[model samples]
Target: MSDHLPVLKVRLFGGFSASYGEIPVSFGRNTTTKAMKLLQILLYHGDTGISRDKLLDELYGREELADAANNLRVTAHRLKKIIVDAGLPSHNYINIKKGIYRWDAPMPTEVDAHQFVILSKDVQACTDKVKKLALLKKICLMYSGEFLPELSGDEWVLVESVHYKNIYSESLQELCKLLIERGDYEEALRFCEPACQLYPFDEWQSVRIDCYMALNRYKDAVQEYENTAKLFFEELGIRPSEHMMQQFEQMSSRLNYKPQELGDIKERLKDDDVRGGAFYCSLPSFRDSYRLVSRIIERNGQSVYLMLCSITNGKGMPMDKPDKLEALSGELLNTIQQCLRKGDSFTKYSPSQFLILLVGTNKENCSMIFDRIQRYFSREHKSWKQYLDYFVSSVAEVDRQDSPIQFNTENKTW
Candidate 1:
């Protein structure tokens, strides 16, 4: 018995990694999920011993098994062997009797997820603002990613993952707020960047934009808003939330506006007033325009149609290859711009698609427009073998009061 050996350290965040003091517990080159999942289940159960039936269900689910009870026995045996080999006391590390298993935690174990929970609780309970800020900062760094992120579809893992993710998001927001209050814009951005990349939550991007605004980088803030809007639409097919839109408005309001001279304004209007091509606008402009058009249609009852176009292979499937998708998207953009009238407005709603608001157009006109654009693209890119798919829906068919844009699943592929 190595009495001087320290407790085992288990890291469940990002992925599962176990070490006893300085020596790592290797599950061998061919690591099996049986032993790893067994350990995860025991850790999750904590002091409460989980029944044999529950463990079998979590591990095997609906899969057919010849002898599940025996399998569980072997898995538990292997897990205990690994623990004992890693220098942990075999006699007390895992407690099993009467078909119930529990991790005894004989040594002072340090699991990242457990530590995160403890630190977060302390941060919440702390009354002193200074102490709370320090605690928040410390706890925020502890969460590298979701709990047991490698295990997906497991009920217990998913539930705990959601719990930890919510804690992480909230902690990040609170930490960013504290840093912003301290006028630490650079440090605030350091927190915001990773948050935005990890998840497409607008609130995280909003914090990053605020950091940019604080540093007097108005252009960067506006650019970030555009990038964030693009990401939301591309990945989720949703517009930016009201909270994000409000942040955009605030950032825009902070910019110094210079009133244009009458002569300069008149000259600019003369050169730019010509309309007859697809008016490419940012995602926010697209949302505002869509709302405005929806209202106008409500009063006048005009035949306004919203069209969505996506790139696909000639076989009528979405193009998944990035290089091919990019090329097709550019070609589609050019085709749509050339084919559509100047009165119409379009936006690159996603990396592989475009959203167009067709004014005073019926189903026949919409089809003709799609056909023309397809024909032009086909003529220009004869070497390409992909198709541009379009879906058209009437403005009246949508519930405009609820959402700015509603995607129509029924689409016509070329």
Candidate 2:
């Protein structure tokens, strides 16, 4: 215990577990149930210490809080003893003083929820294309399962549970956008399936359909729409929105038009290789634009590059109101296209951001193109520019050892 670093990892977004290095640390087998509750409270507050009264409220609700106080104290003592016996020092993980408990160590532990937040922040801060893509990959790895799958009846846990679930869902959506931008429809579909399953909400299903359409899997897209409609009707007793139905209609119309052969598609993708690399970006606004941009990019024979940028004004733009955000997005797309070569592509990665695929160009050229477009948009839409500073522009070259693309904006090279 003395040789090992003192630390406890709290993961509330997914499963709950505490470990010291390679060995698993437990709060006594007998106290497992009580310890789980206590840990949940601590995780909800992050690194802050939780008072005993707060723990009582979280555990017993409005019922007899006094009756459980002694029992909780006993459980806490047992939990401490278990950790001590497991070769963990007394001060290594949990700290108890004046009936307050908090994690007091520094080592990183595998807590899925904490990992989710950290990875998400990393993805948001990352400005280099290769690093952003790598971060997105890590984000997917951290989201192994639903939050607190083992706990169900506890109302307190449910609150934190749903919060993380939404974070996981949003992270998946961002990952899908990145993969789709790279022109990797198959990979995008892989990411979207889980999201659609967990969050059968129309948005996730809609994204899944977009991925199917990008792969030119029109039948699958149509089937997805039908299945989604059924789920919506059964679960919410509501029909799919007109916007969603319109997408289905579009895909239905394309059913009779045969797409390019697989071999042709591959050759076309290869020819449009921009920088021989890939990156991830965010576009919370252009959920529908993702599919459209994928089709446009593939049709024009271009590789996709991603730069995940977050948009703060996500809820401000209503998808149904084309006169507002949609029209603005169209204008931005047109502006971006005008600044790029004939083979380039652009798609909304998140509500406030977009990913640009500049074919026949490397990282340097991509930055210049994006800068020009950014400048143009800034001058044209002063309000948008004020709200959304071109947060980040990361560029990665494709096929360069197939490793993650790293960007050096100062040097303007990948």
Candidate 3:
């Protein structure tokens, strides 16, 4: 058996990185280059060894290279130099026996993705529950993020990433179940919270909520549920899944029955005293207020309008840079707050956009409100200039109960 790379621990999850014991091995500045990609593919395939033809397809996908095989040879040659040049004692590095290319180093390498698979299989075979639980926890920890996330868009990386992620999700779920069954909810969170941050949209948030509920952390459970629901709405434009809703349903019942004094409850529910200007809120709160207003307008015969405000570069382009958007967003926020009244409410929809709810305002009045915002933006935000786009929707007309509201999108740039 060949000796392994001396304490070489390769990390393919989250990002591609390697360490020889405590010292790091650099893959150079640009990880997306073809040479690095060749290295990654060979390392991922490991002992199974990717066939030469398969490597060709993965390396160059249908761009009509004149000599594709020759190109791959050059890439592999460069990869060898990079590995040796990065201070690793070199051997052949990439070995091909009868056209099956493998990572042929002097010694074996400990890759996180491979180690995760090995441990997961061990967990499955483990008869002792305690040992199995420990293995499962290690499996969850090993998958810090998706495999080669920076290269996730590539076809080979995408397939492998998905496979790694599926294993991670299943392993984490199993670990949490074991912990919850054993009444070790705190220990479960030590694994689940990091997973939540890495895969927020993947329903690991549900696992976190489960941990919170198991520990009798009713408030934390409710807060996590609400935050997860809002994240789903804002980012995915979808509601939480049925399973997630079921989890929240269990927590919601707990949320309602809290023992508290009536005075204390009132104090908790009370908002800060009126400070004038539009009541700025989060997108979720804006959604709630918008729904409440829609219901009330039918009975009160009052006009309500929904306006979308967007900040953009001139010539109808978007201002997307972080530094520029921060300055422009702040200026636009100030302009909207200063121009709108106390009755109106606005929420930031994104860094470059806001949703404004103008109550008791007609079509013409909506225009007038926008005019005020535009004038203020032009005057105060002159040095930091950005164009504004505002779209107004009449709430009554939108909710008229005449037919389903097929929104005539009123997007306009001011």
Per-residue lDDT value at 21 in model 1: 84
Q: TM-score, each model?
A: 0.59, 0.53, 0.60
Best by TM-score: 3
Number of backbone collisions per candidate: 2, 21, 3
- Which prediction has the highest lDDT against the true structure? 3
lDDT string, candidate 2, 101-213, tens digits: 77554454445666678888887788887788778877776676666656543444534555566566676777777778888888777777766655564257787788788
Cα-based lDDT at residue 289, candidate 2 = 40
Which segments of candidate 3 are over 4 A away from where they belong? 1-5, 246-253, 257-414
Model 1 TM-score on a 0 to 1 scale: 0.59
- Per-residue error for 403 in candidate 1, Å, reads 25
Candidate 3 local lDDT, 1-414, one digit each (tens): 266347667899888999876889997989889999898888888888999998998889736899999999899888898999998886778888999999877765888888888998898789999999989978887787767877754546644655676688788888889898998988888888887787665667887787888788988987887798787555533445556666666776666754452344234223334454578998778878988998998898888888888877553567645654665577688667756777899999878889898887788877767766776565412323336877777776664556323233373221
Cα TM-score of candidate 2: 0.53
Could you give candidate 1's per-residue lDDT for residues 170-209 as a string of tens digits?
8888888888999999988887776676665334878888
RMSD of 3: 12.9
Clashes of 3: 3
